[model samples]
Target: MAIMLYYPLIEPPRDVMYQGLLYWDMISTIVPDLADPDRESGWVRPSMMSPDMAAVADAGLYTPLSIASHVEPSVGIGGVDLTAKLRAALADLCSEMPERELKPRPAVEDPEQEIVYSDKLPPHCVDLLLENGLARVARREPMLIVSPAVHFTLLSVLARQLAHDLTAWQRVADRAEPCLPYTDQPWAFRLAHLPATGKPERCWQVELGGLLPVPDPSVPVSEVIAFRLKYNDERVRLVRAIRNLLRRLGGGEDPDEVFAELRAELADALSDLDRASQRRRVHWMRRSVSVLVALGSAAGAKVSPDYAWLLGLIGGYAVNVATTSMPSLPGDQGVDLSYLQRIRKAVE
Candidate 1:
């Protein structure tokens, strides 16, 4: 199963329909900070390893990195410089030494550094990202990153690097096909066609916008990835659903009313949704090369149904989608949005 990791932050609870409700087999709390260290490392300075290590943390990262803050007056005079004489002399001696058994221990790879990897994405990027509230957990399977949006160039860079890493895309590329998995084996079932291997990944990104928030009208659609919404209907519907659910659950805020209303309402809605889901039992369906599926409509086609252009209009390809069943109810972490999620799932 593909693990879903949110970038920047988790998707808004209200619109979990497109963000949380599809594709991934599991949800995770690991918030990956993709922010570049090159752009963010104001804390770094010279005396760093190499230019390529600009993203890497340097001794200067903490700034004025306390050499006893005064260096004990050095017994004579300790001048401030990029390199210390004792350390500089040691480097020369180490260079002359041979068959070194006393060498410093080899630096082991930290599990965290494995999260972001690309010749283009600097290794030190994670250093800054971590400093800025990024966290990490481990996953054995490939990840499907979900977020509202990222810079277009960043998205494309991620696509190029990660497309090959993701098992689904790798299988497709190795087979020279643009198809995605029809089964949830790796949890890549989607509503859009990804570009064939060696083709530009940006086109695939445009179609992926169908699962994200709708972008502003002033922005060119090609410049971003947003849900190909019908007048922002899905977003509006999600927001409305959340609001309604809150009003009903608000009764629980008052202990007196909780017993009177919350318990009864909860029992009823759960019962209703359980019955609805069992009756519907929606599963993945193969999509035509040129169609866009609406958020709630497992059947109706949206504005664009001809997405052959997404594959460069080259070879024909198919996309996969399913109203993936959420057997478990939303937990306390997302309890506020529980009712809306239940309502949306029940209807679908």
Candidate 2:
């Protein structure tokens, strides 16, 4: 099969979504200090690589760098400039050297140059597989949906760290009860869409779960050749919410009663916000609240009760905006109030 290798951040308008989600956010968050593969020498030491790809590297090729702060020397002689001498001597020697055994390494000049290639596909990279044929790239938002075959490849490629963690988790669970294989579990199946017929499909989710043995061994060497190709910011505003609920659930504070009571209060506040006279304002308020609930829910919170807070916030804001006819103003009437309201309601 001819593998489609799409370069991230290179295709301009067509690649914007990939760049935004994978390059700008995922890559940066996961590895903040290193240069992206797009730049020369933009290497992330294999040892320091994300929990997944560490084993893929040859043993000695990857190593971490050390960083530390130091006070300037108080009385050192600061007059030696070694650049001119070093360059001239190296250049003469390099020019005389035969180009048989070794190639000279490039000189370091710009510190900001990047280097961007990796062995496996990251989440956003797999999205490109949705563009199976050249013809599909022209379709509207093809990357937005993908095939089960592609998803399997994607999930299988996620950081092996996640697999290792799951495996360890399973060991404990197994002790409690004999663990069933992923294929036997109902929730382990993922939904995919078949091409041509455009029908929904189901398949076993990628096997990312398992407990790793101590001193995590390298991934089997055979797996690397089998694969064809490759390759958030938010702050909490509510101090009390963290203190009363997250802290307790996270194992810092007190009992369940207090957390439950606070939840009820937050819901009432949301309800009050939703009842505002301006439907647009209420909708806007709810949308904002919904985002919070979604985030909290993703973190394992009970989002139903908190849904009110989001509803109230989005609704109150939407109604206020509608009542003022702000979005309908002369120059800036492009805002989609109805769309915003629907989003807000979804969270509620």
Q: For candidate 2, lDDT tens digit of each residue in 1-348?
A: 000111111111211112112111111111212445674332455454433334322322122211100001111012211122222222332354443211211432221111211122232332333232201122232222322222222222121112222233434555321111111111111110112111111111111011000111232322321110111111011223322332333231222343455555444433432332132221121111100000111223322221111111211222111011110101111111110112112222
TM-score, every prediction: 0.21, 0.22
Per-model lDDT:
0.24, 0.21
State the lDDT of candidate 1 residue by residue for 238-309, as single tens digits.
333323333332222322233244333433433443343234342222222111111212211221332332
Clashes of each: 5, 37
Model 2, total clashes = 37
C-alpha RMSD between model 1 and the true structure:
23.0
Please name the candidate that would achieve the greatest TM-score relative to the true structure: 2
